[model samples]
Target: MIKIEQIFNKKDLELFSTEEKNILVNVILEKADVSKRERKLDIFLLSEDVLTEQILRKINQIISYYLPQTMSVSIHCDKLEGENKGQRLVTKAWKGLLQCLFTEIPACRIWMLNSRWELKKDCLNIYLEPSGIEFLKGHKICSIIENYFIKLGYPLKVVFQEKTEAETYDVYEEEREIIESILKENEFRNTETNINALSPNIIGRIISGNPVPIGNSIKGTGEIILSGEIFDVKKRELKNKTTMLTFGLTDYTGSVAVKIFLSGEKKSLEYRFKEGLWLKIRGKIEKNRYTQEYEVIPFDVNINEKLERMDTNPEKRVELHLHTRYSSLDALCSPTEVLKIAKKWGHKTVAFTDHGVLQAFPEIYKASKKIGIKPIYGLEAYIFDDESPVMILPPDKPIKDVTFVVVDIETTGLCFDDDEIIEIGAVKILNYEIVDRFSGFIKPKRPIPTNIINLTGITNETVKSAPPIERVLPAFMEFLDDGVFVAHNAEFDAGFIRREASRLGISFDNKILDTLALSRIVFFKLKNHRLNTLAKELNIKMGSHHRAVDDANTDAHILQELLSRINEVGISNLSQINDIYQLRKGVNNLNSYHATILVKNSTG
Candidate 1:
């Protein structure tokens, strides 16, 4: 597997410390998948992550350095467009043929593992490197490779030659000014990856090197080393009275079981192969003829430590939320391992907010107490807070006559304390009708961040000539007169208004309704309660999401849709908004989501 980051050593991965290269290697191999039958080394990933093209080619070059010239390689991205280009080159008939040659003939294993084949009407051309040509000299592998296919009713002369290098690799040489040259021509990249850091001597010589991800072990390949935690070990007495340990190994990507017969001194080490112990095993992924499933046949087992990510940030961010195994069906991370790492990173506090289960609390307390960190106990509780009055300053006259002003505000940032409201958009919904609309942009105290500008398309240039906050705030307050305040997340929009008013010494209080809160009970089965999600659910035509006018209009439709179904949840008047959810029944009805409440002080 090519670690493009290491070969090219891009700035993207330069943050990893000198000592953390092992962790980087582990992370890289985690994404690699190899399928020999398909002749593909698919590093298919679509994340905001970077691996330099040159580094990738060099890393790949390193992987094939020891392999035969028969393995011509090139890198191609199969993203947004999809991986429709065919990868399968050799047919099923070519399986046992390659495996037999690999195990018996050293020359074939070194040169022919990834042999390129060009099947023509007249003959089959097999490209090997010049060295591979010499390795095959005086060896009968070419005749064996070709004759095996001929016996399968395919007659064609097998021609072997040096493979043509892809044009992509040649382009890599042109970019050597900024990027360090990773590999010289016909040379290997550094083979000192962290995968084999703690390789203890096993068998005779050290059985360690690159460990292929279990997901991409290039099925039926020999010398496949899988490094990860081992578990589910079962010891049974063999017919010869020797002990055999059958256990499963998982690198988090995939899992495979290994059945190893221990002899003499090795029998005493049965307990060492149990759960929670991470081990790197060198072996072969062999398929069982009867069961038709692949399993590992171990040759050497070495003690290995799973790489724990370390936070290099001087001011580390607080891990306010985490889920343990008790979270149910979603996480395998236990409280001990999580807190151990958090404590190691010098985090003062850690919180366990598992999904609705306090079963993890007892364990969380013990772990945090032992680790000398404050533990905030909480869960992603269901939405059923009767104590939280739904409508703030309820008008007490919202049975049907009260108008609802569905308002949305785009701000400079999240917190209303310091962040300013840049724009305000509102729609008046009188008895399910969009009777009026209001939209305004206000100049902020500071320039908008580049990312926010990109996200909302709200630039300083657009708002520079617009009215300042002093003028826009008063107009918005007048437009929002007496109507029940409504927004997707009413608190966020309403809070900004309150803050702006308070700053100017204006008394601002209104009847507030959260369409977000309403959607939870009204459309309880909805996967999420986002504004766009609700609008889409109701088939509403929405404008640009971040724009004030369009989002307010869309949120207005969402509010009306929720209002139509409010009776289903027994919520009618603004006063009865609190009754939308009744404790026990409400919790039992809705699905759980991931959230957390961290108590940092004595007030909690």
Candidate 2:
């Protein structure tokens, strides 16, 4: 019979030899006992350094492959002789042997076997190892044993040897004295509570280390607070007597929209929320990326318990880059009309530079701010004579001989003499469609004001970091070589480009067409000519109103509208129409006049 006994003194622990240590390690490994008590045997043997490098390496290999994190290993030894030495050797050998068993066998089953050893009198007598139970307790290894036993339809019990009466009496006396002294202390009474009378509510309030029951209950509606803007609300009818309210709300936490299906009691929330108002909401929170936050929604919202008003200032400051009917032949709305709509859509500020003409800028600028939207002024113009418009806007590969370029320039202030071009934006159109675009903000050889930065979202920081205009202009001219210049107000953009090119010792001579004139001849209903109003009237989605790409795109769209109008008016050839239009506009010079008339008559 193995008598299990605790090794309390160092002298008794010294009895193990390298061989015995190895045998013990092998025993624990074979037993598959991972309990803290079983593991202590490994710790004890490891402390003695009885393991060989080959064995240690094998153990480490197993651990690394099976464990989540690396574990520390140690080996300890004092001598190398006797059954104790043989036992150590056996234990170390057991470590390797146990690995083979555990390679296929589970650690839990080993724990179950170890736990059952306490119940077996012969096994318990032979092993008399208190360290086994202590190690198990430290590692909470008995829980794994309990789980295995439960799965096997068997109950597990941990049995300890009964203590003598004298021993129990001594322990009771010691505990009693300690308890009495603790009760006599003032601080102890405040911190310690009687466990019997503890209720859930009292348990929650108590801060002392007393065990308490945790109960579950349905959460009440009074706990949640909801606030957001009502972006949309729609009422829909259900079967016979039911109705539904679909609403959307956006807040800092992000947007949430819901469809509430209702009958009688559910309709009680009807008075709580209204269209375009803020309201406090109560409902089960859900997670649905497709919808609000939840896919499978659970609770119906109890809304209208609270409502708050928010400021409704329609005009908000935004970047100014928009186009109107005045810039496109098919555009139907004016700059003033676009501003009015922008005001309705809650724009705080607006810009009114028509395609090429600043003509509507004065009126729209005056009217926009009066209606609470700030107004900006700028034009979408054209670049010509530097490169073929085909380079910018290429036609469909199957078609040939139709090309145009639209351009816009931002300069320092409005004075023709003092202000110089600070930025250039252009797009090429071929077969009446935009094909390519160029946008660059140039650093003028002068300082820019804070007002310009605030208005244009451009600053010294940007220009200081950009390449010099002298470097950019040549590249731009090279890109624009031989393209027909198309602009809302052709003269302004063409005049600026011509002036800038001549300053750089380059000639600027290109055929030009004004989208403004084309719009006047095609769609005459505009009260005022501006790009944004015309774009909106034409149902174009105008984004980034003042940016070059946006304005160039709008100009390209205008060209498309013009060609469609020309087709509608029975004009068959674009080259011929463009020549006649140029002659009638009186902007054509002697060379351009003869060339255009020759092209027009020859095409006819």
Candidate 3:
């Protein structure tokens, strides 16, 4: 008798609240289909079986607020005989009321008949049907019912009557009782506080926010362990007296030289050297030049000692030189790939010597250390003299050509000893490359003029904390390994070295070579013979033209190029090149007498 189609219309939809309107729209959208001609629904009126007084109150409130016309809404409890005419009329009236409420409130409605009440003699049997569920899916209608109950401050469980058993329904009285009990138990109640009940360890952990106490100690040999990348491992002879393991070590503390006396079995030390593992040095703390900040010179190093993994600090060890892919005119590799190439070449030591800036050093050092290779610190510096830049080589040997020291000096002016060396950078080179390099700001025995710092980029802040020349010279000498000292301009660096060495009461008698002279001889046709020009001509990369390490490295590369050319021309001995250079220096112009003397010497 109560028809859902008659009540469901746009005019009826205007009666619902905003939230109910949204729910109605969603329900209708879900059920409506363009393909369908008509949709059917049923309406039902049913009493809540398990609903308590609290739930009924909430339901009444929702009905009053959203379905205002349906005030005094009630659940009727009545038994009806099969197909009784009066009972049918009552049911129809109830169904009509449900249809009106569902349609007017702009909501989908479903009813559940309490099937669990069927066994009770006092329970009323009922039929339940959806009033407007054709507008929404069953699950969606159930969600709406749950949301509505929540909004109304009721916590009753609502479920959809199955499609097959649309006429049968049941609800449990015990379910409502259990829900009420749970809500009651969950109401706020604070526990009694007892500060003394906590364990001391628990209290400590809570206070410190750490699982273990800071005071906890681990038992071991009390020996302090240090792990670092081996910057350089060279057999150095110092003062023409002591042969020592003059190696540079870079760790978390900082980079410094570790001078180990080579009295032990050479084979034993050699095995550890070949292992090429990052070393864990356990030795008594001894201050050494190579030891940048902290010194631990072990008399015996266990090469087998496990290398601890450490993160490379970007601030400490930056790539002073590197070449990008864009450097096609000279360099053939990217900054990252250059490190890979160096690693492949079995070069435990490498410096990025890229033209200008320490930009690439960070990435290069990070990548190199990952592959178990320690990079030697250096930069290939270019020197500009009289508007012409020059490359300086590591000094020659007796004074071995392969083993020479790379030195960088920041001077007040070009006159060497007259212009004090304000800063010094030195690295040892063997086999035509940098093995290790040292860099430090030096306090000029005299005030650093503004012009000097501006030109050299060495600020007062940099040299402010630098050790005095007296302190720096001795450490520098030890780091040099009495090897040939080299720089971009040999005369400039040699003058500073000789002056500084004298100041320290030590004599520096190492042989010297100018890479500028070497470059001029090898690439004579180049228009300009400056360091930058020669580096570009020879396809050599450089970095920070004025910085000592960078300039030193540029000098190193120029030396490499010259050595390559010498080897090409079948000149195996460096002594022959030195003799030729010396002879050329002796004669301003080669007359017949000089030519005959030179031929006689060549034949001899």
What are the per-model C-alpha RMSD values against the true structure? 19.3, 28.4, 39.4
Model 2: per-residue Cα lDDT over 179-211, one tens digit each: 233223312332454423223211112222321
The parts of candidate 3 lying over 4 Å away from their true place are 1-401, 416-418, 579-604
Give the distance in Å from residue 522's predicted Cα in candidate 2 to where it truly belongs: 1.0
Candidate 2 off by > 4 Å:
1-400, 578-604
- For candidate 1, the 10 contiguous residues with the lowest summed lDDT are 178-187
Candidate 3 per-residue lDDT, tens place, 261-334, comes to 43222322332443244554544454321111334444334333343434354334434344564433556676
lDDT of 1 by residue, 1-604 (tens): 2233444335444545553444334222214466687665645332122445654554556445423332445544422222321112233334556666766785566577535556666466777766787677558777876665554333467778786553112222122321121112101211332223333533223554878788777467455788877777766553444455667888877888776655555455565666888777776566644234577766556777796657989997777777789978968998888888888898877777888788987788787888887777767765544455556656556556778888988888897668888889999988678899999999987877657776788977788898988899888888888788888878788888888899888777777888776677767777787877878888998879888888999988887777777655666676776666662235433444444665556775
Point out the worst 10-residue segment of candidate 3 by lDDT.
591-600
Candidate 1 pairs with clashing backbones: 68-110, 68-111
The C-alpha stretches of model 1 lying farther than 4 A from their native spots are 1-388, 567-572, 582-604
Model 3, position 535, has a per-residue lDDT of 78
Q: What is the lDDT of candidate 2?
A: 0.50
